[model samples]
Each structure stands twice: as C-alpha cells, then as structure tokens.
Target: MLDTVGLTVAEGEVYRLLLVTESASAEEISGSCELDTAAARRLLLALEAKGLAYPVEDSPGWFAAIPPEVALVPRLQRQSEALEQTRAAVLEMVQTYQRGARARVGGEAIEIISGAAALRQRLRQLQDGSRREMLWFCKAGYVAMPPESNQEQFAAHDRGVLYRVLYEQAYFDDPGSVDNVVEGVRAGEAARAVPRLPLRMAVSDRSVAVLPLASPGAPGSPRELKAALVRESSLLEGLIDLFERYWEVGAPLRVTEEGRIGGAGPEDAASLVPEDRHLLSLMVAGLTDEAIAGQLRVSKRTVQRRVQGLMSLAGVATRMQLGWHAARRNWL
Candidate 1:
C-alpha cells in the first residue's frame, strides 16, 4: 500500500522492517526481506531519497524509518491534490477534443452512434461524466437498454447528479414500468408524465445530449437502432428548450406510503383519495378509458362509473366540463 505513496514494493518492505527496530543494517534488511545485500542497500537508499527512511550517523549503513504519520500522510495528500488537478485537466481536454472533432467533421456537432450496444455505452458515458443535472424524455418503447438495465442512473444519483425525467403516458403500458419509475423516484429521481413525447432523449449537464435519429415507427431491430450524440451546439440548446417546455406541462408523479405510484395532487384536492387523484391525473394526461382501466386494474365499467361520480361531485354534465372544473379547482 505504501507503493501508492511513491515507494517501491521492495522499498516499502525495507521501510516496514526499519519501523520495528531502532536501526537496521543492509544485511539485516536483506535477510528479513529475502533480498540480496546490494538490492536491500539500493532499496534503503531509494526510501531515504523519498524521505521515508534516513541513515543513522552513529551507525554507518544502518537506517531508521520516519514515522508514517510524518512521512506518508503528506505524500498521500499531495497525490490526492494531483489527482484532482488531473481530473480537471482531463475534462478540459475532452472539451477541446470535441470542438476539434466537430471542426474536422465539417462543423457537424452531432456524431452518429450506430447499434444498440454503442447507444447504451454512450448513455453510460454521459451518466458517468455528468456533474450537475440530467434531463430525460422516456418514450414507450426502449431503443437500446431497458429501464432496469440502466444501473448508471442509480450510480449517478448517488453522486449527487440531479435527474429530471419525463415519461410518456403510454410508457406505463409496459409491464413493471410503473414499478421501475416508482423505484427511481424513491431514489431521488424527479419524474413526470405527459400525453405524448416528440422523441426519446437524454441530456447531461446542459452541454451534451443523446437522441435517436430514426423515426419512431420505422421498422428496425434493436441492433439496428441509430442515435446521435450531440455536443455543445445550437441543436443541443434547442433540445434542452424542448425538454423544459415539456416539463412545464407534464403531470408530476409521487410514490405513496403504500409504495404505489400516485399523482401529486394540489393542496385544494386534499379531500380526494389517492386512487381518485391518480385516475384524474391519468385522464388529464390523455389516457383513454381502456388505458386508464388497464393502469388502475379495473373494468371499463368501473372506470366509467368512477368518472361519473367525479363529474357529479364537480357539478359537471360532461367529461370535458369535468376536466375543466378539475383544472380550475386544482384537483390535480
């Protein structure tokens, strides 16, 4: 372990041997470390040069270790500082390379990444390198990796990277997708839902984004999926603006005490039960009656009856009027 602080392995062994005794000669070090006398002497000299060992004047050819607290701690601290500086320099170099690559590629800031494997790798890279925030638009069908496979998301959360995710309402049609979203929310991800999304996207730190370039309905296998990694450019800025606008209109979701996903109801709807609030939220988010019934795990008739009751309570005669009243009264 001392090798991490600039000591060679053999030198570290010699230093350890010196620490246990008042002083040690090259011959003693060689015997204890299984090294020849010449090799032991060279290691001792190297340790001395590193300030980890010093020669004793009273006894020529003998050396003593400097206490680890005095000798090793400063070296470890300096290594830590140097590592931080290296990290900063690496980030700067990455930015510079991005600019140069774009210029060399005829000023195109978007680089095509083909195949699902490449897309997944790019997503992982973005998540790992993110420092501040990540914005996502999750559509119904996954093009690269599924929600559960994106372990980088949880890792990024632990690193204090804020995640703002917008899921298309139809995304919940998938089995276990709701549970996955709830799990993410429990792990500090902020999630919302909208009736539809224009495309799938993930933007990291407002500087880079990865988005599918193929048409959503185009026939293609997972392995054939193509995406574009966009660096700092006008296109990236537009994508960020698109995310912000969708976020503004999205319906927020929350995890209930029962571990179920519920809509985040307004304060004015305090009397509304959790189920009713969730149903209304889905309705306002443009889910069909069948879809809502599927999500709530009830029959179509049951959903219709509940809607009628809510309409009656809101004093409305039509579903449209009920929605207007709910919005006016902050029911969701």
Candidate 2:
C-alpha cells in the first residue's frame, strides 16, 4: 500500500519488517531481511530522514519504525492532491486536442488510428457500443484478440444482434483456430470460411468499419499493425457490399452433432441454408475433400462423416452415382 505513495520495493520491504519490531539493530535488520549489512544501515538512515524511523532512546545503534498510520497517511494524501491537479490539466489539454482534430479532419469520415494500442481501444469501444449487427473479415497477420478479451459480441448476440463472421482458410491452419467461432455459434452467431479474404476488418451495426492500413502478412507482433476507421459513408457502404459478396461464397461453420441435414425430400431445396447448398455446389464443382474442408472451417474428418451420412440417406453407393441419385431425391 505504501508503494502507491512512491516507496521503492526494497524500502517497502524494510519498513514492513520494521513495523513488526519495537526496535532492531542493523545486524538484526540485515539478518531478518537477508539484506547486506551495509544496505540495511543505509535503509535505516534513509527511513530516519524520511520521518518513518528514529534512533532508539537508549540503544546507540538501533532504530524503531513509526506506525503506518503516522508515517504513510499524510504522504498518500499529498500524492492524491497532486494527482487531481494533473488530471484537471490533462482534461483541458484533451478538449483542445479534440477541437484541433476536428478542424484538421473537417467533413471527412475516415480516421487513422496511428498506434496498435489506440486501435485496440477503439475496436473495443465499437464492439461495446454496437446495437444491431456486426460483420468480420478475418485472415492471417492481423491483430490476434482472444475470445475473452472482447466478448461484447457474444452479449450482443444474446440480445438478438446479428453477427456474421467470415474467416480466410489460412486462419484454420492451427487445429483449435475455430474455438472462438464455436463459442460464437453456440451464442447464435453466423460464421463461415472462405479460401481468401480481401482484407481484415470489422464493421459494427453497419454504421462503422475498421480496417488495417495494410494486409497483415504473418503472425508477427500485433503492436506493429496500424488501422483506419471509417464511419457512415460511401466507403463504409462499399465495404459492407464486399463483405456480403464474400459471405455468399463462404462455407458455413458446422459443429453440430447431426450428420445429415434438411432438404431430404424432393421439394426441400428451399429448406437448406445457403451455406449447406454452397457445400453441395462446391462438391459438384469437383473440389477435393481437403479444399472443401478448408472452405468450410471444419476438419476433413467432419466433411467425410457428413458425406457418408448423406450417402446413407440417399441410398447410394459411390460418389459419382450418388450425385445423380441424390439430385433425383431432391437433395441439392
């Protein structure tokens, strides 16, 4: 607690040791704190000058510590008063800076957030302040945020906000890369995977967008990344359209236990979600299983299992034969 008043680490240790003692000689202080004898003597004299210790009345070389209430309270009060004065000055300076920023930016909706720290703070604020919808375009080389660090989206989802996330294929190279998405899906979020992403960005409530100044190339220091924020304007609108275009091509996340899905009967093509239909379209387009899995943000094993389940439901034996049989069965 005394450290808050600017006490050094070693000095705080010495004072704490002294507090439990009525009086101690330098030899005793050095032995008790395991400090060098010379250091202990220096500490005691320093404490004496600081009004926190005094020479013992009868003992020639021993010293006694003042009680904490008598020693630290006044110093802490003085520090608090100084801090309040500094706070007032900083507030006034911030007002002047804001005015200057408005004059410089004048009527432009774009803003450059220079440092990684400021970008992170703004992202957090955007997520916390969003009310209706959020969109994401994620790829490698961008700032890596842990799920727990900024979970405002999960709360927003529970409140019935729409959150659509699209991840580039490279993002799933790590085995557990989709854990965050799994949590989001469980909370009613919509997630998908695309082979490539045009940029790394997040748009909140369709009104604000944040994007990196450059494509982050690899998992380097997040501190090295810089970004820009665009508020309601044509640029933000164009970004939204780009995101939706990617979303339509991306494969949906499937982590559920059910192997076979809707569109079982001859007239149920309309029942399938766009992502499931896209998976079928890709399959018919001759993509390999690994490629399909990469696009879907799921394990190859999961893709295989789902395929086998579909074959069983269609009563077909081979991949080539199943396409014809499944198509006739109204499985698109």
Candidate 3:
C-alpha cells in the first residue's frame, strides 16, 4: 500500500544512491545507474531541491553525495515541523473567517417588532424551532406567568432539546407562579431561580439570542426600545459565558410544600401540595407530560389535569402561548 506521504520512484532512487555512495561525477552516476546524462542531471537537481544532495564545487562536472543521516533526516524533520505549523496557522485563519462571517450575517437585521402579534410570532419561532439547547435568564415572576407558549414548550421537550432557565428567587413567593413552574418541571424542563440577573435574556440553541435593551424605567411606547438578536458565534460565545457565570450561582428548580415551586431549598415534604406545581416544574425543566408523571409517581392523566389547571390560571390557550406569556412576564 502507498504511504500517506507521497514519493516518486526516481526521487526515492536518487535519495538512496546519495545515502549509499560517496561523491561521484554525473557521467559516472549515469553510467553506473544505466541512465542517460540528461536524466541523471535532472535527478540530481531534483534531489538538490529536496535537500538530499549538494554539489561538489571543487570537482569539475561532479557532485557531492549528502548522507541521509546528515542531509535527508534533518531536512525532512524541518519540513515536517514547518508543515505542522502551517496547518495550525491555516486552521486558526479559517476559524477567524467563520466568526467574522457569522457576525456579518447576524448583525444585518436590526429590525423593530412593534405589534403584539408580530412579537408573538417572533417568540413562537424562538420557542418552536430552537435547536441544541435553550438558555434563559429572566425575572422569575415573569416566567411563572408566561403568556402563551406552554404547549409549545412541552412539544419542544418531547423533541429532546435542552431548556435551562434562570430567574429571580422572588418568583417562588406566589402560589400561582409556583404552580406554573411546577407544571413545566413535570414536563421535563430544567428550571432555576436566582437572587438576581442582569436582564431579560433568551438564547436559542446558541444560534440566536434576544436581550432587552430598554432599562427598567423606559417609557411604555418608546419607539427606540430595542433588543439585540445575535446569531454570530463570537457574540453567542460572550452571551453563553455571561449565562454560565450566573448559572454557577443560581439554584436548580425544585418543588415545595403547598403545591408551590422553589429552587434548591430545604425540603418541606409535609407542606408540599398535590397541585400543578410539580408538573410545571417539569415543563420548565424540558420534560414531557409522560415523563413528568413517571417522575412524580402519578398517572399521565393526573399530569395533564394539573397542566390544564395551570393553563387556566395563566389564561393561555396553548402551551406555546403559555411559554410566551411566561417569558414576557419573566416567569420561565
């Protein structure tokens, strides 16, 4: 079989000859090797190019034989090292080029979505089609009261996508909000509530991220109100880093007594209620209703009933709508 590093027969023969023989005139080499003078000269020149031979300038019409140990080995070593370095440099250049290309494509659309319907459409896209994993940092209260996409969230859970959420701990205080989260947790979502976060953020599969631009006290109808939607890998990396910093300290979602949702807190099994809180928690954790039932040690019908009750309280028609409302409200 041929080796990966290629070599021609003539090139190999020239190299071997130089390795075994002492310096000889071109005519002598041609006669010994049964090659014409022109062919011999061409072979010697080719070997010289490969650093395997050097001319014997003191001798007329003659050349010096470079031993493999002294000439071929060291030269080949250098060539190998240079090739490795060149490959590494080329890989880095390609990576930089890809990052720049993504930035250009993602930064082009600085669009403003004004109406609630358009906003809902955009939110639906985020909720329905996200791949890889979803990362969210928002107000806990807002997610718990999500407006309209709980069903979509559940569907996404069934599709095996990861959903990680971080929010303020204060959201756990409300019974309804807690119930909403419990439902999500039961549906296979990974939920967490923290003391605080930077701003409302939603990242879909590391491909797109949306972050609120307006401050806390911005005017209601401020036309300048905006949010950044970044799909660039470079920017996405920055956002992912920020999320990890907060994720490291944020608590994981858990169930509490009285059918309310909590996060990584002391257990109060006695106070725990049999409400939809468990189901909602599963939903937020990206679990399906069937999975949630298995986890909660209950039947699927029981899980569905709990979801229905939570949806009624949130006043949403579909799971997608519920997720949207919750995200808009910073609940998930």
Candidate achieving the largest lDDT? 1
lDDT (10s digit) by residue, model 1, range 257-302: 6666666554757767877887886675456789779879999999
Question: With candidate 2 superimposed using the best TM-score fit, by how many Å does residue 104's alpha carbon deviate from the native?
Answer: 5.9
lDDT tens digits by residue: candidate 2, 223-329: 76667888888888999999998886665554443322211333545645555554563454335579778777788898788778667766778765555554444
Tell me the spans in candidate 2 whose CA falls farther than 4 Å from its real position: 1-97, 101-106, 217-224, 258-332
Better of 2 and 3 by lDDT: 2
RMSD of 3: 15.3
Give per-residue CA lDDT, model 3, range 13-69, as digits (tens): 655666666676667778778788888888787777766678888877566666657
Q: What is the TM-score of each candidate against the true structure?
A: 0.70, 0.51, 0.43
**lDDT value, residue 232 of candidate 1:** 88
In Å, residue 160's CA in model 2 sits off its true spot by: 2.4
- The predicted structure with the larger lDDT, 1 or 2, is 1
TM-score, structure 3 vs. true: 0.43
Error in Å for residue 192 of model 3: 1.7
| lDDT of model 3, residue 173 | 41
